[model samples]
Each structure stands twice: as C-alpha cells, then as structure tokens.
Target chain A: MTSLPKHPPAKRLGLAIDLDTCVGCHACATNCKEWNTGGISAPLTDVNAYQAEQRGVWFNRVYTYEVGGEGPDARTVHFPKNCLHCEQPACVTVCPTGASYKRSEDGIVLVDHDKCIGCKLCSWACPYGNREYDEHVGVMKKCTLCVDKIYNQNLPEVDRVPACVAACPAKARHFGDFADPNSTVSKLTRDRGGYDLAPETGYLPTSKYLPPRPGKRSEAMPAAAPAPAIAGAGRFLKWVDRVLTR
Target chain B: MHPAYSVIFFTTASGAGYGLLVLAAIFAISGLMPATAWLGFVTNGLALGLIAGGLLSSTFHLGHPERAWRALTQWRSSWLSREGVLAVATFVPAGLFAIGWVFLGTTTGFFGWMGAAAAVLAVATVISTSMIYASLITIRQWNNGIVPVAYLVLGLMSGAVLLEAVTRLFGVHGSHVDVVAIVLIVVGWLVKLAYWHSADTGLVKTTLATATGLGRFGSVRLLEQPHTEENFLMQEMGFVVARKHARRLRAIAQATLFVVPLAATIASLFVAPMVAMVLALVAVVSLAVGLLTERWLFFAEAKHDCMVYYGR
Candidate 1:
C-alpha cells in the first residue's frame, strides 16, 4: 500500500528561494497576505488596533540582518522565513490534535482549523516560527502555498501557483516538485547549491534556499596615485631636496 | 521565550496551585493540622480553588479551548502530555481527599494515600511542564536541563512562603514559619542562581557551513528575504535586547530574586519578625517581577539556530 502510494515522479510541491535574486521589497509577503485574505482557503488575522501601524497578518516575513563573517568581507543579510514543510516535520508529530500535518502528496504543512484548539503548542514546537495564531478565528495560521488558487479551475493556468510566488517582481521564488530531479526547482537548487534554514534542529523542511554565490572580481591592480603631500612642502625646501637628490 | 504574559501567569499560577495542593496534603499526612475540621477544610478548599483557577487560566494560552482534551494524548514523548495527565491525576485524588478528610470523619487511609500520591504527581507534572521548554535544543536559554528542577524547587518555596503568610493570618505558629519560610526561599534563591549559571552554554553552529553542508562554500549570507512585513521570525523569535538595559536588569534581578531575598531570610531569622516579614514580602514581589524579567531575558539572551542569518 505504501509503495503503491509513492510518487513515481515524487511530486512534492515546494519553493526554491534564490536569495541572490530577491530584492527584499516584501511584495511577496504583502501579496501573500492580500491573496490569502481574499482567497477561499483561509484568512490571516490582524489583532489589536487595526488603525495602528503594528498590524500583523502574513504567511511569510522578511527580516534584515547584518551577519558578521570572518575577515573584512562581512555584510548584511535578509531572510524571509516561513514553514519549510519538512520531510520530517516536528510541528506535525508534536501536535496532539493533528491540527498541523504534512500532506504526503505535496509535503505542504497545513493546520486543520476545525481540529485546532489554538493551543499554541505547535507554535512552541516549531523552530522556524512559521506558524502564527489567527486571533480572529482562534486557529493556527501558516503558509499553504495558495492551495485554494492552485487547484481552482476558475483561475488562469499561469496564476495557479502561490500568490507570493506569482507576485515576486524579482523572481526570487520558484514553485515546483523538487522530488523530481528534472523539475525546474530541483535543477535550480542543484545548479545554485540550495540550503535549509535550521537543519541542526532536524525539522527537515522541504523548502530550499539557494545561497548567494560570491561573484568573481577582477584581479588587475589599479595604477597607484601620487601622494598629495608631495605638492604641499615649502618651495625652498623642495628645491633644496631636489638639488640634493640630483 | 518572548515572555508571553499569558504563559508567565499560567506557569506561575498553576505551579503555585500545584504546590499548595501538595503542601496541604503533606501537612495532613504529617499530622500538622490546626486541630479543627473547618481549618483543614478551609485549607483544602483554598488549595482546590487555586488549582481550579490555575487550570482555567491555562486555557487562555490555547488557540482553541475546546481542543483542550486532546492535550492528554502524546504522553509517550511529550512532557506537556505528562503534565496534563498528572494535573488531572492530582485533581481527582485531591477531590476525593477533600471529601474524605473534610466532610467524612472516616480516617480513610486510602484517601490519605491518594492525596499523598496526588501531591507527588502534581510535583512530577509541574516538573514535566517546565521540562517541555527546558529540554528543547533550539532556544539556548530554555534548552537548559535544570529548568525543571528550578521550577519544582521554586514551586515548593513559594508554597511554603504562601503557607507561612496564611498561617500567620490564622494566628498560628510564628517563629517556626519564619524558620521554614526562610529555608524554602533560600533554597529557591540557590536553585535559581544555579539555573542561571548552568544556562550560559549555547550550541553555536556555523550558518553558511551548516546551510551548505559543505566547506567548499567559503561563506553564506542572505542576500534577500522570502517575503516582507515581519514574517515568523519577527513574530516568534524576534527578541530585542540592549546591552546597557540587560546589564542593569540582570543586576536588579540578581538583587531582587536572590541577594535581597536571601538577606531577608537571614534577617527574618535574626531581626524582628516585622522587618523580616517586610523583607520577605519585598522578596516575593521582587522575585515575581525579577523572575518574569529573567524569563524575558532568558528568551532574549537565548540565540536561535536561525538567528545566525541575523548575525546574532
């Protein structure tokens, strides 16, 4: 039965994020929240005063950071984190109510709102912090990869992917079945060298992030410029020095 | 780790309630009763009320209150499951013990032992609850193994302190309370300090190297975020701390939860009961505030595996 259920092509639909190409504008996050809010799947909630600038409702978020590296070549880094929908998801197994579970077919981690008691225990269990509490419905919220729109026949075929992936102007995000070696996402990962968020914690998230490769720099040395101090000395002293050198 | 006020209240209230239940049952077993049926009844009633209140308060943390029953499952691996089961176990025995000892004049040894066992279970459950966070390997501060031991010890200490205060209200033993309360509070201080000392270790992992799983890549850095508007990191592990503020807070917490409390206990032993009592109250308030602050710092101080992207 298990072998029969196995994906011959291994269609585990997930994203391969190219951090190198991402502009860090947060369009993905905004579009995701917007599409998800209006979509038939489910809505993310904004708690407290909606008027205040501190509104919260996003399946994905971008964080700006300055990662210190060895040597003088260190610089800032930006990370947009969400549920990786791991091969072995701790959030799913740790869930007492089975609210959080990974679909064997797509490997997408989702919470069944009806079954979820909003215990927030799953939130604690997840290391990635991808799950958020929708205070409005009192259920856990997470990235669904726009499951509602993806399967909807009413929508255009090009717009079938996640809202976040569709709206990325920088084209940093890719949605495909990485389980298939020939898939676009898988090829991109292999070509660019993809990585996981926190592999040490062992959540084994399915989503992969392609590390930004350091581009090649020219080795040709620039011509040395003359010292400005040479022109600043007293005329008599300069003349004396020149004569002595001669 | 963000020191959710709801969680703080839940752990504190529930732990104290569990401690009170355990203490009262122990008192009954040890024959330290107040020589009146009404007194034992009142003590049991108060303990029971606190416990019920604590359990009720715990539900506030849940997203779905109706699914609370499901928490009883996963006892095999989850400390939370163990805690829930133990909480219920404590409650049933306590209820039976109350009915037997308070209302029924029958010195039912069965009920007595039931209460005693319940007390033991309560302690076990509370410790298990603490371990749920403590055992996690990701969050450096919460990952410490001593968290459970500290929590249980603090529970007993707080219970003893509360007991002393209550007994005083009833015009019961005075000097002996000072002695016991002092001892418990001192133990709490030492355990807390020990916990703080032990939690300093953190699991440092190379971010780019870990991400690549190959030393071939010289270094790794996030050139872009996956999305915008403060995703999960800002929500879950977005801890902020200023060094100056942290140093000041740590000093204040050390004074409040440990030094001040310890000194007060000693003074309570030596000086007038009033001064000692005043200090003890200060210690309680200080410890509560300090521990809460410490909890916040604990979360803030602890670095997550993902934080390497942020250069933390």
Candidate 2:
C-alpha cells in the first residue's frame, strides 16, 4: 500500500528565486493569491472584514533582502517564497490523518482538507516556515504550483503556464516540468548554475532559479576627440546623432 | 502547537514513572536503607511499570500501531527513535536494580551496594530519555538543554515522593529521602520558571515577513486564503493558542506542580509520618494534573510560522 505506480523518486516541488532580477513588485504573490483563491486543494485564509484589512492567502510571497556586496556592487535580493515541497516534508508525514500526501504522480504535494484536524505539528517541523493555517476553514494551506492551470487543457497553450510565470513583467519567473532534463527550465537551471535556497535544509525543490547575470563592463574609448575632420565617419556619426536626438 | 491532551499525559506520567525508578535505584545504592526492607523494591517496580505502560498507551496515536516497532529504525536521525530505544534499555537496569534491592532487603551484604550501582545507571538512562524531547532543535521550547535538566529534576521529585510513601510504610527512616525530594521539587520549580521566562521572550517561530521576506513592501499581510477549507497540513500543524488562557494555566501548573509539592515536602519534616504521607500523595496527584496542563500548554503556546497564512 505504501508503494505507488511510477513514483518519480519523491519530487520536491520547490521554487528557485532569482535574487537578481526580482523587482519586489509582488506580482507573483498577487497572482498566486488569485489562482489559489479558487484552487482545488488547500486555499489560504483571509480573516477580518474590510474594517481594517487583514487577510491570508498562500502559494507565494515576495521578500526583499540585503546581502553583502561592494560599494556599487551592493544589491537588493528580492526572494519569492513558497513551499519547498520537501523531499522529506515533515508536514505531510506528521499528519495524523492521511490528509497530507506528497504526490508520486507529478510530485505536487497536496492536502485532503476533509481529513485535516487542525493539529499544527507540521509547522514546527518545517524550518522553511511554508505551511499556513486557514482559520476560516480551520485547516492548513500552502503552495500547489498551479497544479490546476498546468494540467488543465481547456486553457490556451501559452496561458496554461502558472499565473506567476504569465504575470512576470520582468520575465523573471519561469515554470516548467523540471523533472525532464531536456525541459527549458532544467536546461536553464543547468546553464545558470541555479542553486536551491537554503540547500542545506535539503528539501531539493523542483523549481530552479537562474542566478543574476554578473554586470559586464564595456567602455567607450574616450569618444575619439571628434576628429577635426568631421567629414568622413565623424560627419556620418554626427548626422545619425542629430537625427536620434530629435 | 498546543499539544493534545493525550501527548501531555503521556510525557508527564511517563516522566514521573521513569524519574521515580531512577530515584529508587539511587536510594538503594546509598545503603541508607535497613536490611530486609521490601518497600523500596515494590515502590520502584511500580513506578517503572507505570512509565512503561504510559509509553505503550501513546502508541495509540500511530495510524499503524502494529508498525510501531519500525520507529526504532530511525535512531540515526530521529530523537523519538532514540528515546524509544533508551526507554527500553533503561528498564534493564531498572529491573536489575529493583531485583537487587529486593535481594539485599531479603538478605544483607554487598548486594545492597550492587543495587546502588544499578541505581546510578538507571538515573543516567532516565535522563537520556528525557533529553530526547528536550534536544529537538525544531521545537524551540523543547530545544533548550535545560529540558533534560527539568525532566530529571521533576522525575527526582516524583520518585522521591513515591520512595517516601513506600519507606514510611515499612517504618524505615524516611527523612533523608524526604529532604532529597524537597530539594528536587525546588530544583524542578526553578527550572520550569527559567523555561517559562525564556519562552516568554517572544515567538518561537517566525512571521510571514520574516519567513518570506514579504514585509519589505511596507506591511505585507495575507489578503485572502488560497483554500476554502482545512487541509491536512493546516489540521496537523496549524494549532493556535490563546495567551490569556495560557497565563491562567501557567498559574495553575506552578501552584500544583511546584508550590503545593514544595510546601507538602517541607511540612513533611514536621507533621506525623502518615499525615505527611497523605499530604504528599495529594500533592503528587495535583502535580500530575498540573503537569498535564503544563505539557498541553507547552505545545499550545508555541506559534508556528504557518499561522502567517492563517491570518494570525
């Protein structure tokens, strides 16, 4: 009973945040909120009325960080966080009821809300702090990787991608089947040397983030003193510059 | 993270059971006992048995209770596995010590001193089992090294009381044991107070902002939950607790587990032996219930990072 057909070696559905390109706009968070609000599985909780405006939603959140760098080299690291969907998700195994189960099918971790008891041990077991409680429904919720959208055939082919992937104005977010080595996401991860956030925690998330490209330097060689001749190449450049400026 | 009542009862009752057995062994080794004393043997055995029974009862929480034996396989990574192993191993010495004390009581010789050595081993074993819970880094409250210290102290106090009762029945001089019991009670109380003080500093877990870096945008908050109902992760891990109720419960625990027990032990020095014994018994029962509350609060009061999504 413990074994399943074609278990994909315990896929950890995690995200690799691009510390480089993230603008901290929270588009991912918003999109995640939108999709998860109507998701099939665990939905986040939004409590309190419009009186003050406190609410809960899950799947994604963006954070800004300041890591050590040089003078101009200093940079802001914006991280979009989600459930690592750990290879050893204590949250799933600790469930008294079999409500929490890491899928062997596509490796998407899920919850059966019907069986939940609101016990709360899985939260303590997670160092990443990804699990969220739904007070309204008295259950737990977390990221599902847009399982509905990714698998739904009714949507247009391009739009089938996760909402975060679709909504990224900067094109910073990328989603695909990371399990396939030939997949765009996998190749991208390899070329960029994408690293797991807190790899030491050993969750081994499925999503990989392409590291920020190091800033490159290309110098303009002093403008060449605008050769007195202005006639040949200089005259042509001057004409182009005048037109571009206008 | 409020612990279920079942778990709270499990740890407290079991701790006392193990703790008392440890004390019984220690007392027998000290040779302070008169020859042919059967009281220590019976008292220690009963305490040890109760601990064993409590552990067995806790297995009911497992979905596949029959597969509980497989839990021992994870000792390499899991403290629970180690705790289970040590719990069983501890009984070996406990039984040996118990039997040795009985023999020494029936006859007199270095057999009594052998009982003391067995007692020392039992003490170490009990401490090890308690540390299994206290050493978990994930559980901020239980992570402190003092958890083991606290368990040992309380165990000693409980054991001391049981010893006091049993020895008094035999009319064996019980003042020395009573004194040790009082010292342990004081020690236990101070440890619990320290634990509470440290725990009170702030949340054991982090917030969504801290967890997800969502706070960078001024004041990031959950606007809506992604799900409509409770899921397994939320049900299993999203336990919420009330601070006001916790405060009330803490007072109750301190009063019963520490205050009453401490007072009763001190008064034992002055009161008639039987009266003193009865008071200690009352104190013991109150302390058990209080500890159960304390254990429940231990989990209840702990906040989880997941509550961030819960809109706590």
Candidate 3:
C-alpha cells in the first residue's frame, strides 16, 4: 500500500521560494503556526509551552546560512524549508502501514492519522527532516501545503493561498502547478534557474528554490546625509536635544 | 540513530533467537543430536521465549502499540512489514517442529523436513530484519552489502555458540559443533572489521555543500540554526559519539564477542566436562554483552543524511 505510483502525477502542485528576496523575518513560519493550529492538521502540539525547552510542531521553518566566503561575497541567505512533496518521496514508501501515502491527483504526500501507528520510519527515511512526531497526539505530522485552505469555498479566491505564501511580505513564495510550463511557479523556476534543495539525494522534489541573485546588495546601507557642523556649545546643545527628545 | 534501548534489545535478542532456532533445527535434522524430549523442549522454549520477548519489547517503542498489527499490511513496499510477516510465518513451522519433536517424538522422517523448513524460515526472518535497516539510503553506514551479511553471519555465530552450550548442558559434546562455532565467529569478526573499514574510508557521498546545493557558491557554513532549542529531528538523528570512545567500544566488542568466546570454545575441547560446561556458559554471557554493546554502537555511530543541514 505504500508503494509509489508507476508514473508521476499529471499536475504537480508545489511552491517556488525566491531566496533572493527572503528577508528572514520568519513571518511565514509564524503564519503557518497561526493557520495550521486551527486548520486541517489542527492543534500542533506543544509539549511544555511555559517550561524550558518549549518545543512545538511546525510545518514551516526558516534557517539562515552563510553561503559564500568572507568579504564582498559573504551574505546570509534566509532559507524557508518545508516538505518538497517529492515525486519519489521515501517517507511515503517507507511507511510500514498504509497511513503514509501520496495523492495521485495533485501529488501531495499525507498521513492518514486514523491508520498511523507512529513507528517513525518515515521521519528517518526523509533526508530533508520534514516529518516530525506529535508526542501528544501519538502520530506523525507534516506540511499539508494548506490543502484545505487552497481548495476551500468559504474563503475569497485571492486569499486561498497557503498561510506562508499569504504572509510573506517580500513575495518570496509562489504557489502554483509546476507541471504546466506556463504556470507562474514553472516560469519563475525556468527564468531564475530554480533548483531543488538536495538534488544529489535524487528525490526529484516538486518544489524549487530560486538561488539568491549574485552580489546585488539589496540590503546595502544607504548613506546618511551629512549633519551640519556644530561649534562646541552647539554640539553640546545638539546632544542634549537628541537625548532630551527621546 | 539515538540507540533506543527497545530497538537495541529487539535486534540483538531476536537475532539470537532466530539464530538458535536455525542451528537447533539443523542439528535435529542432520541426526547430530538425539531426539530427546527434554533437549527439544528446553531449546525450543528458550528460542521462542527470546523471539517473543524481543518482539513484544519492540512494540513499547511504538507510539501506538495497539495499532502495531497494521504494520504488517504494507509488505509489498516496506521492509518492516516484510519482517513482521516473516517473523510471524517463521513461528508456524518452528512451532510445528517443536511440537512434533518434543511431544510426538518424531525427529526423523516427515518432521525432519518440517525442522528444515523452520530453519529456512528463521534465516529468512533474520534477513528481513536486517533489510529493515539495510534498505534505508539515508544512513550510508547501513545501506551496504556488509550490513545484511553481518546480520546473517552474526546471527548464525551467536546461535552456534548457544547451540554448543545447550548441547554441553545435555551431556552431548562434539568437536564438530565447536569447529563450526569457531569458523562462524571468525567470519563474523572479519565481516565486522571489513564493515568498519568501509565506513571509516569516506563512505559518505553527500556533504554539507551537496546536501544544500550551494557548493558552486563556495564553502557553506551554518551561521544560525533553524531552532534555538532541540527539536524532534535533533533528538532522533543528532546522536554523536567521540571517535576515541567508539574505538574503545569496538575493542571491547572484538574481545568479548569474538576473542573471549573463541578462546573459551577452544579451551572447552581440552578441559573436563564440568569445566567445559562452565566455559561454554561463560562464552554465552560474554557474547551477549558484546552483541549488546555492538548494537548500541551501530545506532550511536550512524550519521543520518539530514544532519548535513545542521553542519554536522
């Protein structure tokens, strides 16, 4: 029952993250927690929220990496990571029960909570460290790609995207069908040379990341306008003025 | 990779069970041992008890122990499912063989074939158990020919040692069984050493750069972690052991599992029957401790591929 499909899905729905513009604010991660706690995979457990080591299950997480050497090439890249919804996800195939499976229609991998025994083999099988165990619920939890919100009829058409996609202030995350060449995510990947997170592992993930643009310096500090030169008494007055103003 | 005690005990104890079953059946079938009722009862009881205890202990590690039966449903794709199915199937023939030989006193003719069938099933179950770890591509140390080979060989070797002890207890001493145990022990040690060599020599094909797909930019380092506190992934896969400590454990394993047992087994042939039985029993205890330590290291030393993202 955990065997993979013989052929890839006709419409591979996924996300394309633009690393060039991610500001590392963690809005997506926060937004994911906000939405999913009340959404399809509800009440993401927190073992001890008020105590030390307050760990909670999150579908989205952000990491910062120093990609290049020091000096001009040095830059901190903000990486937002989640399930890639792989075409050949080991997590699905490694499940001992039929609980873990992939949808043939849209290629989203999911766990059937009723059937899950929570053996944790799927967590070991994933090289990306996406799936995590919910100790309180005694089952595995993962990113459902906001499947409920995306297809819901209660919400407005424009607000139907994933919470992470909706909350990204920099417009770094794009959600669309990747199978169609004309789709927005497909075009973004094609145009920006988006690549998989761990291509060497060869899971053939549907999600792609647009690598940070080289040496553009979007975060460069703007030069401050020169302050008027002040005499000894005037400088003292200016200092007092700034201090008293605050 | 955290070396959970439940799993450690399960693999080692169950392996010994299956191994003992294989050799006991073989000895009965080949007419090497007499079809004594007490011998059959004691040996089969010990084997079945170990297998059942080990299997039961494994369930405590699962989050939903009541739903553990559902694990057997996905045998077509899951090695764990196949192991569960095979482990249960092995019990049928092994139970039959035990019943026929111990109760009916039929060790030759039709029951001998049943004994043989039980032996084959035991071997298949052990192999299936080995494949549960060996098939995982994420753990490079386990995804090799050596893992399965080591499991099969060690299972047989441990079983052979137990078989020798049981035979000695029943006043049945034979140099042939000792010789077989010696060869299996030596082969097990050699395979283990070879496995260690392979793992030590850059078995990892993925690196931090390759795993992150940022090698073209230059050397990548983790400036900050995704979480300030430890998460599930870190707890499960972030187990690390110092090389110095690991080396010491390896030496301990070699001496107790192979060297001590080998020497005791060899000395048993020259010693008096009373002393020989004591030596054989010593070998069993030492080998059990040794296998436990080895299994612990097996989990402790494995580096999950996902750790690359954390700059491991």
Q: Chain A TM-score for each candidate, in the given order?
A: 0.80, 0.79, 0.89
lDDT of 1 at A63: 64
Model 3 TM-score on chain A: 0.89
lDDT for each residue of candidate 1 in B210-244, tens digit (9 for 90 to 100): 64332343455555544334434555566665333
Please give the DockQ score of every candidate, comma-separated. Answer: 0.19, 0.07, 0.76
For candidate 3 chain B, the 10 contiguous residues with the lowest summed lDDT are B235-244
lDDT of 3 by residue, B26-119 (tens): 8888888778899999889988888999999898888899999999999999989988998898888889899988998877778888888888
lDDT of 2 by residue, B65-145 (tens): 565565454444445555666676666655655665565453224554545554565566556556655544455666677
The number of the candidate with the highest TM-score is: 3
The candidate with the higher DockQ, 2 or 3, is 3
Clashes of each: 10, 27, 0
**Which rank order by TM-score, best down to worst?**
3, 1, 2
lDDT of 1 at A154: 96
True contacts kept of each: 0.30, 0.06, 0.81
Stretches of model 3 off by over 4 angstroms after superposition: A216-246, B241-244
Model 1: how far residue B115 lies from native, Å: 1.2
Model 1 alpha-carbon miss at residue A191, Å: 3.7
Candidate 3 chain A, run of 10 with poorest lDDT = A216-225
Q: What is the interface root-mean-square deviation of candidate 1?
A: 5.2
Candidate 3 at residue A171, lDDT? 99
